[model samples]
Target: MVTVILTMNLSARFTVQGSGFQSSRREKYGNVFKTHLLGRPLIRVTGAENVRKILMGEHHLVSTEWPRSTRMLLGPNTVANSIGDIHRNKRKVFSKIFSHEALESYLPKIQLVIQDTLRAWSSHPEAINVYQEAQKLTFRMAIRVLLGFSIPEEDLGHLFEVYQQFVENVFSLPVDLPFSGYRRGIQARQTLQKGLEKAIREKLQCTQGKDYSDALDILIESSKEHGKEMTMQELKDGTLELIFAAYATTASASTSLIMQLLKHPAEVMRLFTPISGGYRTVLQTFELDGFQIPKGWSVMYSIRDTHDTAPVFKDVNVFDPDRFGQARSEDKDGRFHYLPFGGGVRTCLGKHLAKLFLKVLAVELASTSRFELATRTFPRITLVPVLHPVDGLSVKFFGLDSNQNKILPETEAMLSATV
Candidate 1:
């Protein structure tokens, strides 16, 4: 099983290798069953009832777990790695920094970065790789708004290359030797951390008398609080986690959101394309809907599977966005069934920020710009860690008069209601 899974994932034609196992397995296994993946004894649980249990039962019944490559590359001190009380504290600090208030404060910075990026794109007047460009744009936001770095133009290209390699290879083999994803991720993480350490130090020294507002300032303030302070290494590890959270997943979500909006004219739609679900290591033996799941097991509640399964979503393969309308409310089939941002205490802290990022990007694209796909046919969906259109959807961009089809409020409200 490990050989089969690894062969499929590590092959030369890796980019278009999105897993279709969930669709077939849900048909055969009825949304909850044991399976082997990544050379481990694993349980793949789907459906709303089952998903609710895993996410809502976090910590007491299950604890956070990630692949070896992910754990090693991200380090142990990150909020993603901590559990129980420690996880709560780390997340609290993060929540305060990422709150709606903080988002509004950072809005000006975000607006400045995006406006400049769009203007630069306009000047090109040629086809561009939307996926790659999305990643670059999101990374710029992370650097300026989260870490407060100037990042010279000469250095930006190298910085992007390092972070790109880390994200691209984060799911590969965990071997730390040369030519391994784990090694490259480790090296890149170190390079990023060293630069962050300097930034944090300077932020602390310079912001002593003035009011501080950036994400870096929030973190530095938390680190100085008596009895609740974070250590330097913890600060650095947390920064790496922040960059990963802000840049990679948001970039992917932002890219996918635009594609969905562009295709909104079509009759069918998939509400969410989950990047990946997480593993929850069992903390004690328990029965899930009469099935015994032993302690030490690595289990994940499958988000994609639940989204595709028939019981929760009618005509699961069709692109009917209104399935989530107040009249239908298909996602309400199970209180725990629809998990776009996950569930329970461990739900993604950055979800609000990511959502806002995509919302603004969608509005900007739909309102001020007219774009045409350079490729006539739609590209295949591929999961290179995250989903991407196979060709990155090369497209030509041109400005539109701000008054055209400006996405009426009622229609926009209906679109928002769908997902």
Candidate 2:
């Protein structure tokens, strides 16, 4: 057993060394010895059964150590590090704000924010860094949708810098040195906490009925109901925790989606073509060729590998949205195969909202503009706290002609009906 473990550890190390992304590590290892690792079983997850069990049955068995790296940045009791009934209660409270009704109410506001961000991009040089733009859009959305306030540009810049520092240290060696990234992350947490405390205090004094109807309202109301209202410190940490959760994941996924589309022009055109069948194809292509994730692992699903797996996709590596449209029934069993937001009980609570946000943004961008990758060479993929194209996704966006800008009445009607 020791020899088997040791060999597996060495193999895993070599695999990771060869591919910075975990999905690539799994692909390199194939189905052999999926278990075994070095260090404390930091995130010991395997197989779909194991994943389901941990995520659903014995979830508490898994520690929130992964987020401890951000504890200083997010408060200790922030939802990410929260456990047991408290976590569940908090989730329940927040769920109300994320419901379809709540989201629909916020749709017009969301559309306005997205449009403004896109308009800003329109005036810039044609080849814009889409990764950066996506981050900005998501960041702005988080503030407006969850915090109920618009962050000033200067404050947004400072906050993002601190956030970036904290994210960079999430997997760093568990040591704090003067001026090191981990130490900086700890300091950043302190700054964020102070800001959050002030905000919570202000919210506490507001007329109850006049409170902003964002996630903050839900959290405050829930805390009050339990007679365990968040203290200034708790409020600060919790807010940051929520923002980080929504921001980083969405930003990363959106960036990856765009990159995938750009890499396959045919798929991009097919995806945007006006056809009921084409829409489904875009969804499938997004699933396959986007990521490969192991069934039972509790880690973030690898959209890249899940998108490229041979068993789930015909030419898993190649971008082909048609597969999704034509093969929906065939891919039914593979629904859980491409979980960009994770799966089971722990699946992203904000998934529907995220999808709505993505769909609307995609509709707006594809319909009103023509865009393409400006670079001929594939940019190196970098894991900068989140996956990003190393060179940044520079693309030229051409505004649609007046006639081309005419909304597809059916599509507009569909979106409105959903709203």
Model number with the top lDDT: 1
TM-score for every candidate vs. truth? Answer: 0.86, 0.75
lDDT by residue (1-419, candidate 1, tens digit) is 11112111223443434456555555665656776655566777777787878888887889989878888778899888889888888887888778888898776567656656665565555888888998998887887777766566557667888888878767766777997777888888788778778866766666443333777778767656625577788878887788888887777776676676667642222444536577889999777866777888888777666666637677767778678789998877676666777779888898888877776776677666777777877778776687777777787776665443232334312211211
TM-score: model 1 vs. ground truth = 0.86
RMSD of 2: 9.1
Per-residue error (Å), model 2, residue 287:
30
Per-candidate local distance difference test: 0.71, 0.55
TM-score of 2: 0.75
The runs of at least 3 residues in candidate 1 whose Cα sits more than 4 Å from the true structure, single-residue gaps closed, are: 1-19, 208-212, 265-270, 310-312, 325-329, 401-419
Under the 3 Å rule for N, CA and C atoms, how many clashes does model 2 have? 18
- Residues 220-330, model 2: lDDT tens digits: 777888777777666676677777766766776666667765655324321111110000001111111223323233232233343344355566556666665754633
TM-score: which candidate is best? 1
Cα distance off (Å), candidate 1, residue 48: 0.7
Q: Give the residue spans of candidate 2 off by over 4 A.
A: 1-50, 60-68, 202-212, 264-310, 401-419
Clashes of 1: 3
